[model samples]
Target: MIALPPELLPQLGEGLWHLFTVFLRVSAMVSLLPAFGERSIPTRVRFGIAVAFTMIVTPAVPALFAQPNLLAMVRLVLTEVLIGMALGLSLRLFVLALQTTGSIAAQATSLSQILGPAAADPVPAMGHLLTLAGLTVAVLLGLHVRVAQFLIHSYTFFPIGTAPLAQGLSQWGVQQIARSFGLAFALAMPFVIASLIYNLALGVINRAMPQLMVAFVGAPAITFAGLFLLFAGAPLILSVWSDALITFILNPLEPPR
Candidate 1:
């Protein structure tokens, strides 16, 4: 048997450590994405996906894994993890806007009782549907390619070991968060308006027939109407969602030039 080279071991160890850091960063990002991070997704599967992604991404950003002392290396890894998480979370916030709309629509349609898993949080059935719709729109619009492009661009704005933390993050992240809310409310507006009309009609009906049980009649009617609206508007809703997702992913970090 041939003897192995002893000095090569340190170099190999350093490379492995750098790879590990990359994995951590990628894993953190994946762990927060809509379907990828949802509770229904098994942990082992997410881990495997994260590892595979890291393997693919590591080679592309060679500057990230350049040689450094142990302490500097640890800082680099931490920065990567922070920046990746921030980026993923920013995208995920838009999904929350959909979730918020869902919850409101569900309540308005009197279907809030139905519930499902959508993320780290539990959501009403309508909310869950909205979440799924948003994710589907993202995928159909070539989100995989966008996400890859976004990650590659990160090395430019944030670099490897110098991602901004507390002070810098607050200044940069607030506007994105506010925009997400604006987009979410706009997406839900149609359903919201529909619900208001339906409720107003119900109110008129109640005022006319005091003996009738509006509770039973209103519940089923609202639910059915909400479902119908959802089916009718899904395509349009998804179109807006896809556009918002593109905007979110394309400029996740620095203010757009």
Candidate 2:
């Protein structure tokens, strides 16, 4: 072991403390980050990812130099965790939007029951597909790089050892929830419209030919239409979802347009 000089010792200790503080925030955020924070990923791998992110983010953020007492340290831990979680949840909402869109589309198209149990989560097949595809596209589009920049930029808004105001935080949370649901509905609009038209046509046909079994005829038609729409519209749906996600990453607190 190499002995460090007294002057270098203090600097080394400060560097370690800074690293530890940044790691606390990073690890908390990584627990809910898009690709890195999935339930399927091992805990150890996630931990390693958090460490890697800390290394990348540390250089960009200003160092926290104040020495913390026991109480202050506890406060710091809670504050960092809260801020990290808030940031992580904001990003996670985009994933939730994709899932919600899929669920809405599936239900509208009468495909909700098909392959509902395929994923670990209790979402429908369409939800699983959209969620998986959205995540894949996000990762492909340099989500990791954007995340690093997000982490670094977060420090500007939420500085070290400071807690966000509760009222403002609550307002932001509500806005994000509203925006996500609106986005989901918008993306699933095509399926909803198709379903409405199919139902109206089926009702008219049933009225015109009372002897015919319209349910049997309409069921297959709706199913086929749903599959065809999914095949044709998935690219556009994913594109819109990706753009929304990128916008949020670029400016998280912006109100929905």
Candidate 3:
């Protein structure tokens, strides 16, 4: 092996340092990404994905990753981690939106805690189904490529070496949280309305026939209605969720159009 001149070593180190800095942001994002960041996947796989993504994204923003002193590097790393976590959390919240909707629907339809795996966060079966379906659809829609693009574009909002604006981020956080809950409620609205109607009709029937056991009569009817609604509306529900996630990835700072 031929040894390079001592002077070239500093340039090599600078290049490697730049790459490492980019890797920090990418790895941080991937570690908390939705399906990519799932607990089911191995850490090694996620690391590989982050490295591969860093390689792809570094070229797009070379000027952003300049060499810096130790103090600057520390600040930059911290900034990158925060930015990555923000991006990842944004996407993760999309999944949670579906979970919220499903839980609301299940509870409304009297189907909570039936047939879903108890070991994984104790979600209702309907919640598990919707979450799994949304994740699967996202993967099929080229989520990895979308993630790469998102990271590249994120510099627009959270530029390299610079921390995000705290006041703006705080407002954005509030908006995103409120929006998630609102979307969940919207998705579950049909079931809620159905539940209200079921209870109202049951009340009327029990009032007319005081001897009737309305709770027993209403349970099966509500459950069956919920199952049919799920069967009928799943495609629309998943499509809405997928569009929302993609919208956030493409333009996280903007509100949904």
Candidate 4:
């Protein structure tokens, strides 16, 4: 390895000190991201990714630690981490919304218990499927690029080395949670309506043919209908979910119309 001259060491140390403060924020943010935050990923790999993301974000939002001593550096670390986590968590809510939608959809279609324990989050097969697909689509659509842009924009809302307003943050968080659940319900409404109709039809048919085995006939019919509905509607459901997620991530501060 090539060694730098002794005089350059102090300059290098200063740069690294600023970089480390930035690292605290970027790493916290990445820890909440969908793909980057998964528990299955190794800690070492995630740290490396945090380092890479720090590099991408640092140039855009210049470090505030220009002449930081120990106490100033500590404050920078705390403030940066808080801001990063706030930004990352806003996006993570959308992912949680997707999971909630999937679980509701699976339950509505009577497919909720297919190897539930096998999943990392213990979601049904359908829920797991949709979540995976949605995540893949997000990545392919360039989530990393969007994240870098988001980091740059965040500095405008949350300045360096400043504490966020507690009351304002709390209210915004409540609003976000409500919005997430509303989105989940909206996505699952179709399946829920289908289930209701299927049940009503089953009741009518059973009443009209009391002697016949309605359970035997209705089970397969409903199952087939559910499968067909999923096949036909999965694309639309995913499309709506993904679009909403991306839109919110790109425009976090925009009020929904």
Candidate 5:
């Protein structure tokens, strides 16, 4: 059996405690992190990711001092979890923005119902596609490395065992939500414009030939235009979304431009 010197026991205990505290925060964040925290990923795999992140982050961050009492320890746990979740949700908003853009586009182009039930989130096919594509692009662009840096930097933004000021946090949350919706609408604007033009042209034709089945003709036309637009515009949309995501990660508190 292996044995450590008696004097080393206290140091070992303190080190373990520090690792545990860091893990509490990291695990909470990983539960909602993109790619790593997807509902499709198994819980065990996510847990393993959390541990890996903890190992990377724990060394960069200063070790937490030993807690003096049970109450202090409980407070530390709660605060760390809260801060971690805030960071995770901030990044998760980018994914939500992509999904929202797809839904808006699908609805505008009358493609909202196609394959709606296939996705885990019950989103339309366009939404599912955009979500998957955005995730893929992010992963391909070294999202894991950026996320590691983000996690390490979070300690500086939110110190250990300190809850953020509630008012500031609320204001920031509202701004992020607003920015997400704005980005979604901006990304889907092309589809919206196409829908508008199609409806206008359909109305003109219906007025000129009242006896014709305009609905049948217009429906297929709009669907084709929607699909073509998606094919041509997806690259640009994903590019813009990627830039926004990276900007947010680098400076979460910056006001949206």
Candidate 6:
């Protein structure tokens, strides 16, 4: 790459700084993402991916960085980063919700002990399955393409250097995040309900036959039932989760007032 003259260095600096903001936002999203953002991936690789994303994104949003003043430029760049992070994280939150369902399922079905790749924080067996399913669906549905489309459309609506977001949008975002918990629970409810009934039956059996090793017998029974339910319900559960993901991605961007 040909180096710019010393006088133009300042302008170059500004552009690169703007790009760094994009990097920050994209990196934050990648950090939280399902497969690409997992802890198992090396930090260097993540940084590289962020740089590549920044390069791809910076050109599309150049109008946002036309301000020549340093402070204004800084503010614009920060805004870009925030917007990118918010967009990326909004998509990521669904994956987190799926993992939440998995965690609940694993605990309920006594399958938490099964070892698996540590996805985020500490992952359980169900967490792995959920993450895998979500990732698969995301990839299959071309989430990357849809996300890019959303980002592009966001510029048409919100534009760069737009005013700060309204309190209502922020509040709405918080509500969306809060709703994910309920969505996750709904996905995991079948397994949870099955486990509850199975455990209740075991308790009744123990009371009715004090001498029997209900605990030992109940273990296999619950495990088998849980596995069977998981196999039966995985398809429908994934469908619901995928629909939720699409709805979220299609929501309009909230421009700052």
Instruction: Name the lDDT of candidate 3.
Output: 0.86
Clashes in predicted model 6: 0
**Candidate 5 backbone collisions, by pair:** none
Task: State candidate 6's TM-score.
Answer: 0.79
| lDDT (Cα) of model 2 | 0.92
Best by lDDT: 2
Residues 23-118 of candidate 1: C-alpha lDDT, one tens digit per residue: 767888888876567667899998987787777777777543367788886777788788889877877887888888787777777777765554
By TM-score: ranked, best first: 2, 5, 3, 4, 1, 6
Candidate of highest TM-score? 2
Q: Residue by residue across 1-257, what tens digits does model 5's lDDT show? A: 99999999998988888888889889999998888899999999999999999999888988866654898888889988998888889889889999899899999999999865667987889988999999999999999889989988888988788789999999999999999999999999999999999989999999999999999989999999999999999999999999999888888889998
> Could you arrange the candidates by lDDT from highest to lowest?
2, 5, 3, 4, 1, 6
Runs off by more than 4 Å, candidate 5: none
**What's the distance in Å from true for residue 126, model 1?**
1.4
Candidate 6 local lDDT, 1-257, one digit each (tens): 99878999878877776676556556666666556666778999877866766677667765433545788767766776676667667767787788889889988999887776555567787777877887888779986676656655666655666644678558757876776788888999988898889888988999999999998988998888878888898889889888877776677443212
lDDT for each of the candidates? 0.76, 0.92, 0.86, 0.80, 0.90, 0.74
Give the TM-scores of the predictions, in the order they appear: 0.82, 0.98, 0.94, 0.89, 0.97, 0.79
In candidate 1, position 117 carries an lDDT of 52
Residue range 1-257, candidate 4, lDDT tens digits: 99899999877886787677667878999998887777778999989888888898777776553667789867777878887888778888888888888788878778787666555887778777877888888898888888888877877788777778899887878888888889888888888898899889888988998898887877777677777877888888889878887788778877654
Q: Report the poorest 10 consecutive residues by lDDT, candidate 5.
A: 60-69
Error of 2 at 96 (Å): 0.8
| Model 1 lDDT on a 0 to 1 scale | 0.76
Residue 31 of model 6: what lDDT?
A: 67
Better of 3 and 5 by TM-score: 5
